[model samples]
Target: MCTYITEPVDLEGSAKGARGWQRIERAHVSFDHPQHAPLDHALEIDLIDGSGARVAVELSAASARALIGAMERSLERGEAETGEGAA
Candidate 1:
């Protein structure tokens, strides 16, 4: 079953695609059937840039959750070191 659940977020970063590093402008996050992942459904993340360059990722639900946790932890440590508040 396709969930058709997607969320678009504006981003300011760079992603390495086939062509090389591109300035990422936005990201589309969805939970649906993956194009290549070996699972019935996976978390899909498509990072896109202004010039239409893109970096795509598909992760299992458990992997996605772990990634999220790692990101949060890294951000927390970074913020503490920089004396910055969470954004």
Candidate 2:
């Protein structure tokens, strides 16, 4: 079932697209019927630039959770390297 809900967020990051890495200024996260994934429904993330450049990803709930965990770990590692929370 499609959630029919999309939440747009301001993003300050870069995503690799067909034209290589590009700055992404916005993102839309939603649970919807996927356009390409094998699943009937997916957690979809669309990264978009102001100049009309875009990249899309669709993941199952389990995969999305795994990815989120991986991202959290990566962020923590980065912060550790930079001594973000050290006294």
- lDDT string for model 2 (1-87, tens) is 768879999988899989889899999989999999999999999999879778999999899999999999988898889878523
- Give the C-alpha lDDT of model 1: 0.94
Flag regions of model 1 displaced more than 4 Å: none
Clashing pairs in 1: none
lDDT of 2: 0.91
Relative to the true structure, how large is the alpha-carbon lDDT of every model?
Answer: 0.94, 0.91
What's the distance in Å from true for residue 43, model 2?
0.6
- Strongest candidate by lDDT: 1
Best by TM-score: 1
